[model samples]
Target chain A: MTGSPPAPASLPGDDLLNRIRALRDSPAATDTGLGRELGAVADPLLLHEAGRLLKGVAAARLTRAPATRATTLRVAVAATFTADDVVPLLRAALLAGGVDAELHLCPYDQLGVQLTDPASALAEFAPEVTLCLMDAGALLPRDWDPSALDGVRTAVRDRVDAHTAAAAGFAARTGSAVLLHTVPLPRPDRRSVISFRGGAALGRIWREANIALLAAGETRDGVYTVDLEALFADEPGPVRDERQYRFGRMAWTPAAQLAYAREAAAFCRAVSGLGRKVLVLDLDNTLWGGVLGDDGPAGIELGTVYPGDCYTDLQRRALALRRQGVLLAVCSKNERALVEETLAGHPDMVLRPDDFVAVVADWQRKDLHVAALAEELALGLDAFVFADDSPFECGMVAGSLPQVDVVALDGDPACHSTRLLEPARFAQLGVTATDAERTALYRGRRERHRLSTTHETAEEYLRALGIHVTVGPADAYTLPRLVQLEQRTNQFNMTGRAHGEALTRRLAGDPGHLVLAVEVTDRFGGEGVVGGVWLDRGPDRWTVRNLVLSCRVLGRGVERAVLQYVADTARAAGAAVLEARFRPTARNAPAATLYPSAGLTRAEGPAGDDETVRHEARLDRLPTLTPDWITLVAKEAPAHV
Target chain B: MSDTMTTLRPLVARVSHHPAESLAPDTRFTALGSWGSLAAMRLLAAVEQTYGVQLDLRAYMKLETVGELASEISTRLSGGAETHAG
Candidate 1:
């Protein structure tokens, strides 16, 4: 079947094809179409080709063909007549962000009656994502006797509560998420109509009711609430009679309502785990005003007024991604030295050569440039996206690859970079200890890779670096960083397991378990706590519960030092067998080969089931404990630093 | 070593918003930190009016240091601006 139709004001050209080729070539390539267009490249044909190539690459990566086509969410929506146009607009936003949702229109029919039966209807639907168009009247109920008004008040309130609660429960049960849209409460004094009873009445009750529903759902563990009141405070409003509905007092204008819905829909998609990973960028007309070969660095258009100011802002934003732990690499078609000089010497260019983790700025096919980037960065091909102003290049990548995510932006170039905030490309995990050292660390890795090419064998390259590895018991300061590493490191991670703050505290408190953090330092610099090991001791056995090594330190002989520490320490503690496990992942081939090389015997011990490869090594007979490259150093807690 | 230079310094070095030059004498204490709490307060009747965030007297007083006050004000201002833009 065909892919979902593109969103409104559809971007020009195909995005999926270029992304696929970029991904096939390199999982690390980012879609640069938007940034390049915004960066102001003038050649439309180049823009067309670049965008097409990007789309092809993106499509190939995403064609995983799930056995059962992923279910589209059943969304029950409710909104005021004033916000009638919002649902479809939101749907477009959600679809554009890759959320599979089918709207079940439950538009508000004068509010009170529509909300009364929400629970039974919502529970019957059992939606993966639930959106409550909350307002004040539904939340803050009127003080009326439940027995008198035919039980309407209590029934309405309870149903709204149950609907929200059920949605949250479904999310927590099915691993889906629920969101509540809380409309801003109309300011009371501004909209209050004077009654003969001498009290001025405002329409804020509708907004308050929504918040009450949100609060009721929040009391339970699963439901998450969004504060729309905070979102629409300064939004423009539709033209309304000042005497009716409190006019200027309303927080949102019709235009603002549309904007708010679009933004909310994007957020829902992001939090739901469907986001873009890579952001391929271009050089020459894209990175700066003129071509790098022609502009001669100092004469380039970046870092000045209007168009130049835009690139500066974009660079500043790219740098912020480091804090979020997004790896950045270069895929510009330019002379490597010229691009390097512009990055370093141009005062206007905020991004330096060190900012990108890998560079593929050669005259070869764009498809090949992306492929090399993936190998260098060690990311999956499907996770790539390419953006370029050149549609031809985009089409080339798309036709060549077909699984990468390619976004070929159309319209004004200045606003292209800002669109990078689209919800579909969100990565959920927060920053880890590895994030702070990313740019410099990746730059160091790239240097090592470049240096390795000159040597004949991999061992010769490894021996050249004066590498030192230190392994010891994790203490107060080290535990926080270790926990952070466990939560973020993907490749070389045993099970892709993650831990939170509470779990970190518990790990430190458990005396039976030992947490070891390994420090690696090479010729370039000191890589702080690049490896972590969690060991659980039970009588005569020591089990390795969690083991992860940063990709930055992989193949550097740090893994051996870590295991040796465990074996010797276990022997000292009087434990017998040291069992190490190997779990396979698409990006962890290096780790799958680790166990066999460590001299542990693999056994197939099960019938009626596929045998998991397990390694058994007796701690007592483990070789004469000599930490060849590692020297056990008693370092103070990192906190004191 | 020069008594004349030392005594006339404060009168000569009064700073302004100009980029590291053209500072006037008696240009006010804003030289330490620009658009600070005191200056913000002077600009508007209350913190609630000048800033998007409502400020209690205790909250205002906690900004004892000039730089801290500037940072607090800057954070609130930026947050307010972001909420408005959103």
Candidate 2:
């Protein structure tokens, strides 16, 4: 079937509305195609019209291909003011971000009670995400001491603390990730005698309160702070609409709400671990200014100057991402020696050759090089984000490798850094110690590869590495990496469940559950928390809920060791039978034979039943072949668990 | 100079989902049968954003026809006296 026709740019509001309605009514209009058609429109009015029309499209009637995974996210908004319009905008934004969102907007002025009360709709709804949209006027006390700055600061901090506690409490109860908004600083009133002093005092208090809010958000897992204050400050359009505020208690203008919705959608996407991973950057004018072959190393526009500083700034930003564990790869069509010389000798270059996990400096097509990098790194093509200054290269990669996110740079060099940062392609909810040590971990892979090449056999290579595996219950230190593994590990995943931090924590703390995090360290370096297994502990049988290992640690016999440890632990804990189930996905074919190979007998299934294969390992007759290459260090389960 | 009718007619037409040529100066928003609350708010935001004039809620409520809205917008834009049609 053909895709829906794209709506014309100059179509009148009514015509556009009719077109959108027609698209929705058409049986052949796929959800993806319709979403794309709606998203392509640049004008707000046309987009709004399309959104309004699509709202009428029956949820059941919206047809999608089986391959297209649709995540139904239940989102609750607890705000001080009316969100009737904002809710729709947010829903549209979420749709644009590739999720079908079901929004529940709490009653106005009931944000405090609804969040704190366990019996509130928020609890019953059990939303995946809750947005606490608040205003400064509502949060701060009206009768605080104006003259005494310290008293005001203390009072503000107290109020912020109470609010944070309420939000954290709600998140804990519902397992929903809480997104708290930092209250925007009030606009300074000009009539007061000590206007400067008063503004200063208010700013100080608000700043302190915002900082406290961030700290509180950090302490609680799955709680993220959206800097609404900065969002409003950065907004170019009208932020506050007094008329709407007076009429309907609307805190922000429609334009500002639209912008907020976009930001909120990005945040939600990041929380779901849908953000891009690898940043495949081009050299020459992309990373540095000017062409490498023509300009040479010294002639290139880099260092502390006008256009040169811009390129330097871009490199600094890229380096920041590298530090945050984003794998960097160089895909450039240039003389390899010149590029190496530039990276090695360029005094202004912030990124060194060692930073890149994969370097493709040959005269190959960028698309081919990127695919090769993905293969070399064992990451899905969807995880890569291709960035280059040349529009031709960006377009080429984007057209050929549709999975790779292309950050197309054009115009001035000064705006390149801003443009790269603007899309927030690599936005993640939280960074763990494992994330910070990702570059080094990948570097260790190179060492492992070298050892493999030197050794005659796989067993010899494995035995020479001196691998140590530590198995323990998921703790605070290991929770983030465990969650990351759950989100990103596609190939070695058993169930392919992307369990968030809160759910993982709950599972770890539950007595009937065993959430084991496996940390692997070789003679080279420590690959932090490379695998995780969630199991249900029964009286006489243990069921493996999930078994996931990072693709980086695959083929090292670590999976076997992890399974053996689980079998041993379960047997010791009075379990006669240990069972595992593998739900095969397109990416997880590698894990198809894992359970069977580990000596688990596969049970016969009824004809035309689910593809999920159930395997059972009798604890009484468990396999005793322990590989001498790896030493197992099992820690006692936490007392709380 | 041309009155605010020239600037206001197109916006009113856009919000009311009518041709600018079809809109008369005396055309009542109620007579158009399409100027709902949402349309009214859209018009208000468009006017505020386009012309940098913050229309008073009281004045907006009292406005009946396109002519009256134009006059009110003119008064606000020129910093003239307020007019309460009610």
Candidate 3:
């Protein structure tokens, strides 16, 4: 049985472990069986056991399964205790989340030393994410008077300041995202009765410290606080095992560690652009309690009633997601008029038809409808999440389009909202203003698509749409979207290089580099900043380091406009040669001949390296190429600069 | 074979990579070809989890055969409530 525990009669006690070890060692373990076995392990101790054994198996490289499409996340841990004790749990959690983790555990109580020193193991390891694990006890002063509230407050402030400064310094020095664990509140002791009566209690001090840490994360880039207090509060079992803590300095229980690791992996996935982007829902018994066609508007259970409130609450949850830039879509087996009427006329419906970027209400298969929606949104099938209450529909879509994350909504209606929000599939590290405006942008694209079909020729349609392109240097306001584009754009990117926020900031500020963001608008609406390009200027030559454009604006000649702007800028800067490189990737086949197509001469730079095709055009002989139908506006430089 | 032996035999056989029929109650873990430290830890965790008992660390370290491990689990199950895991 896949992902099911072996029958108790067949594998009892020691037999279960032996079977797991054998399965782990056998060739079949990695081939579709490991996930099942791991899923079957319901007991935390057994899970830990499986994790420990799997670590060795992973190290030995005995399993024959193909490697998952995963990023090898390098993580450095600096804690006040033996934090490496939970590394196995963390690895198991990361594996569960479809990520491979490489951990570097620094010496205990050496967080400051490792973070401050440039040549420390932490810096040398060059982790992409650094975790600073500290407990409340570490920050609390020893032998402090309980009545001295001001003194305790001052001490807490000092500790907070020191921790924030260390985290900021680490991020600046190593270019690593800092994940700070909020200090957990201490367990009740002899002072509990008095401390509970006073405002300046130990718990109060801990709370203030956590708030300060959270504020620190908000004020800095690539720094975030993981809420250990909230994690512990939600955990059903003991948050801390006193025995383990006293024996080996293990701060939290295995369950808590597992939860923390899952959160950390989610954060890492978000940072790496692996999180899901779309939420595709089914209508009948999915978004509402009943079918729109059969139940009709009044008969449908979707208001503030017992069963109706469940569906109503689900709709509100979906609306919340939409507000946070998660694109909503509908794929249901219903007539278009019925779906529209229910969405528009249903009294309990929190989501209107406008909330969804695409509504596929037809008799087509759910998988086909989802695929069409992905195409319409210009996103990969993996980016879509299909949720339906029907088991058959969920199974069909799951089997047909395995890339889509299928949430089979079963069980009581009361639990639907919780189920929908439980998976961290759509977790995001940070949401920019552009993210909030994504649904509107997609809506504008739909309008443009409709307008494109009215004209006979592409040029005629482009002229009729009144397209406008603005080319400008990247600034603080546009940097996030530019970095997001750099990280996420795969299909039309010339070189699939993910220049993160730190590098993008450096390039934008450096005089030797030129980074430009392209914003597109048409008569229908603005598509926001849809593309970006980065150029590294040498002494005599300007090389296009990266050029990425969103697929949403692909057919509208935005790529040509951006490329022409780059060439014009290079020619104006007195550069002798303008060069570009096209590094081919699996998804970047659309960009393979981009440089050559733009009239740049294809040339071989070095012998024996054929992966990157180099193309160059002499600035003196370059021809200016611009689209006549669209208006191009060059943004003026800031007056201060 | 006893019920405990029937239940423990498959686990031992699987871990030791021997035939299930080859295992007996007195089969020592040290004699098992694949019974290394890692395997032993895995065995300890699985047995504890499956039986809902926490074997004492000292007693666990002293275990050598299938019967000894099973006896330890039985004793723990009868003596006290299931121990909380960390």
Task: Kindly list the per-residue Cα lDDT of model 2 for residues A241-355, writing each as its tens digit.
Answer: 6666767677777777776777787777776666777898888788888888988888889888989999999999989998898988888889998888888888888999888
C-alpha RMSD by candidate, in order: 22.1, 6.0, 5.4
Model 3: colliding residue pairs = A3-A36, A15-B11, A254-B86
Tens-digit lDDT track of model 1 for B39-61: 33322122232245543334544
Best by DockQ: 3
Pairwise lDDT winner, candidates 2 and 3: 2
Ranking by DockQ: 3, 2, 1
Model 2 chain A is weakest, by summed lDDT over 10 consecutive residues, at A60-69
Chain B TM-score for candidate 1: 0.32
Compute the DockQ of candidate 1. 0.01
lDDT of each model, Cα atoms only? 0.53, 0.75, 0.73
Clashes of 3: 3
TM-score, one value per model: 0.55, 0.84, 0.84
- The per-residue C-alpha lDDT of model 3 at residue A163 equals 81
Error of 3 at A300 (Å): 1.3
